[model samples]
Target: MSEQGQNRTMVEVHRVPPTPKASRSRMWTDLYSEHVDRAATSLGDAEHCPAITIAQLGSVAMIRLDLAAGTIQRTAEQIGYVAEPTYAFLLQVSGTASFSHYGQDSVLAPGDFTLCNNAVPYVYASDGPADLLMIRAGAGTIREHLPSPEQFCGRHLRADEGLSESAAQLCLGVCEQLASGLPEAVHNRVARNLLDAIATAFAISFDGLITASAVLTGRHARVRLFIEENLRDPDLSPGLIATRLKLSSRYLRMIFASGDETASAYVLRRRLEECARQMADPASAHLTITDIAFGWGFNSAPHFARSFRERFGQAPRVYRREKLGVGMPLRAVGAEAG
Candidate 1:
């Protein structure tokens, strides 16, 4: 991905000294702590110098990494939301790399891909020289195109055939284009199209999987029904549901593995939906949005407001105002947990 070689387009290039192998791990650790309040480790020969190049396309980053046989890991202790949360999509270019995240593992060869969540612990390793294209996009930014990206992360995917092939081809072209330059508009549009292609591909793949298994469909339905019935329970969670349903938490999650979201995410969405329903109810206009949230098992007002906005595209106050008619204010409620 050097800026010099192939039919270079119109890119602006900057070069610096090669990063010293002995110091890179420390550098990455410091970077993680400073920005994301986490830690990362790079383990490889002291003489290995990684060649990394990065380009920004709108809010997403396209990076080319040439690595020696080594491992980069974020441990359980390093599991936390990034300063600006992102989902990392790694496309293997040449050689092989293995990625482990969300308790799943994928070994990638050329033209293979895997997705990783920045907020979770993960390991990326290679046995020898490897070339990769790493695409990092904000969590919310990704959801705009792929609503349940979790289903695709930490799993082996291909860029060689099927619907995903278009995404893989687009990404590879864009990565190469980064060395040369594309207009800002061109790159951004490329980013959007790539994401859209991935979402469509994943959706079709997921539908195929689910449609092939009636037992999975039934299990998922039962779990969801239980969640709906217990929406008002403050302690409702995947683990709790598993215990009540006599299923292992891992199995409970697996039932949702082929779906758009995990079991825990479904719980949050249900709670939010219930709260929205109450907020829009004429009789519940007497209650504040906070009250509605708490009634649906949310305990923290700030957390509720943030989650609501992310899901519904508006602040709770604004949503209520519009639902109740503009200029209308919520009536005060007694025992409001104020």
Candidate 2:
């Protein structure tokens, strides 16, 4: 075999051939776990502890993550200590994965696709060892169409339900082609085409089909759920939300207006309340005032302080110190003043 053929041999493809049920299940479990471990190590850090194998075919990085038939525990600290920015397209070839992102959790069964961002801390646990195919793309590329590119900074999004099947098939086809070891030029072109298709799939998946009102409504609900779940994202705004939901700015406003509040107000209230609750928690004594504020989506310390004072009766620092027993050191109080 040539060097190219040798590279191709590194990738193992399962055709889902006819076999006894027990035999197939065992084979899948082993393959999926090995693949996940390999891919996780290849990405930024083993600390991310992703058990998967990754293959680079041109611009696309194809990952086969083996999720053994059991619960896999993941935390922001485990995946990688630092938050990195990248886009991921995940396709489930077998079994299921329960994903938790921005406090919302969903189960993705076989043939389902999800868009995941590495900018946030989240966890995904599988039902058993399952096959997961992932494609990574640059941040700039995925950001262009996002209403709040930052909102997706650390989030996972499922393709609205209608588009999941088609997206899964397309991703599977791309993975198969990459595994075949085409010429470099052909591979690059194919990878780019696949990326475009994947992005389009995401765009349509989140926004729904333009032609079908029912489809659009369903898509709209998913978008709303995302917004509701991530209300503390400081960068959350109408434009960003609209872009992700694939709605015109005016229409997005109308959608929000139809409810009791405007989009911006809803996001702001949610963030403020979340921060207030965190500050009121006695267990949060170890965290600084700014840390609590930032964790709940307040970007500017002064702004958060001001907002807290306005919403409550005192500054966040004072509130935490007095109400939550988070005693502030003199140095820390001076830092907040400055």
Cα RMSD, each candidate: 17.6, 12.2
Count of backbone clashes, every candidate in sequence: 3, 20
Model 2 CA deviation exceeding 4 Å by range = 1-51, 71-84, 144-163, 208-338
CA-lDDT, candidates in order: 0.68, 0.56
Local accuracy of candidate 1 as per-residue lDDT tens digits, 24-97? 65665554344333645453654555555667777778766766676666644455334655887788988898
Report model 2's TM-score to 2 decimal places: 0.48
Model 1 TM-score, 2 decimals: 0.56
lDDT of 1 at 287: 74
Each candidate structure's TM-score, on Cα atoms with residue i matched to residue i, is 0.56, 0.48
Per-residue lDDT of model 2, residues 1-338, tens digit only = 11234345245443323455445444444544443321111111111222445566665677766545433322233344433456667777887776655443568777766666554434455645577778775566555433333323223345455555666677787666556655565766766767766656555654533333554344444565567555556777888888776788887766655457787766666566656655654435556667767887778888777777877878766766675454545433324711
